[model samples]
Target: MQLKELSGQSGVSAASIKYYLREGLLPAGETVHATRAQYSAKHVERLELIQALRRIVGLNIEQIRGLLKMADDGAPRLTVLAAVQRVVLHLDTAAASGDRPTPAADAVVRLRNWPDYPSDARNALNVHLELMESLHIPVTRELLDTYSKAMDDVAGLDIAVTTAPDSVDQLILTAAVGMHMHSQLLLKLLALAQASHAIRRYEEDA
Candidate 1:
């Protein structure tokens, strides 16, 4: 199809498509003649990914470009996936700082019998623990375990949806979009559950 058809199919304007072509966010199509290019289904797919990153995940142009590069880089699968996860999580590139939450967080992770998490993952937990401590909130093992069990269910769903896809870019895009949107799913689920339970427990007074 031509650029006009591509734009119509993808619901993107022609000028924005041209801008993406120039920005390296979208790859150029096959040159059919001196002034015309022929796009294919792949181009439409790429445009959908680009629009989701922008409209759904709220990633800017540079982040989307970088994410595309990371997904397409010929690194080993696990390495590329780790890179994508870090990008989606917005974790720092540097190694963990080994701050106050490391040991306790490490203990909880070990107790959960999960793999030895990377320092960055541990540190994300640690930072929150530190904040809770500063606010005098009790960080109990039972609470940690409860939250871990709930998140294990979520992580299982993440793997089910993101890992089975053959396209690495699709995997990355699914993870990015799912994590951003489904967090709200969890939040709203909690709110609804609480409301239902509270309604059930309400006692009518005489």
Candidate 2:
């Protein structure tokens, strides 16, 4: 198919498709003429994936590029898919405005002004704020403090689990499958483990 046909079929604008091709996110089409190029089904699939990353996952252009590279290099689609699912879940929970006031819209503005926050956390915060705003929930300093504490606790545990040296791939696979198949059971296991460890530590201190 020609560039125009590809663009029309993908619902991506011709100029944007050209930009993606220029940026190396999309593969170059076969040159049929000085100004005409032919795109194939692979181009169409890649363009769809890129669109989903941007529109559904709320990833920025740079992040999308990195993801595309990883995808093309044969990294597990499950990993990328998991990350995208996480982002979409966050957006759904946090963007209560029914897709109108998504975190992506706020993140674009916030990143332009603030240079300190880590990109991932900043994006998450943007989603949280947008969600609150849409729900008319007051974002008090106390509420922020509580949220920060909760995040700190979860982050500590995540770091510990993710950093464990043996079979990181297996661990990720377990997490992915476990979370999918038995979410409540997984939560229960984690909760019991935490309680047991806390009790043991308290007894030792006493």
Worst 10 residues of 2 by lDDT: 168-177
- Model 2, 90-164: lDDT tens digits are 432443333344444344444344344334435556666776777998766555555455545664565464445
* Alpha-carbon RMSD, each predicted model: 2.9, 13.8
Identify the candidate with maximal lDDT: 1
Runs in model 1 with CA error above 4 Å?
92-101, 196-206
Instruction: Judging by TM-score against the true structure, name the best candidate.
Output: 1
What is the C-alpha RMSD, rounded to one decimal, of candidate 2? 13.8
Q: On a 0 to 100 scale, what is the lDDT of residue 141 in model 2?
A: 54
Clashing pairs in 1: none
Candidate 1 lDDT tens digits, 1-206: 99999999999999999999999888899999999999998888888888998998787888889877766565666666665556566655433553445556876777778887565556667776776777999888888888888888898888788777787667767877887778778899999999888877884421
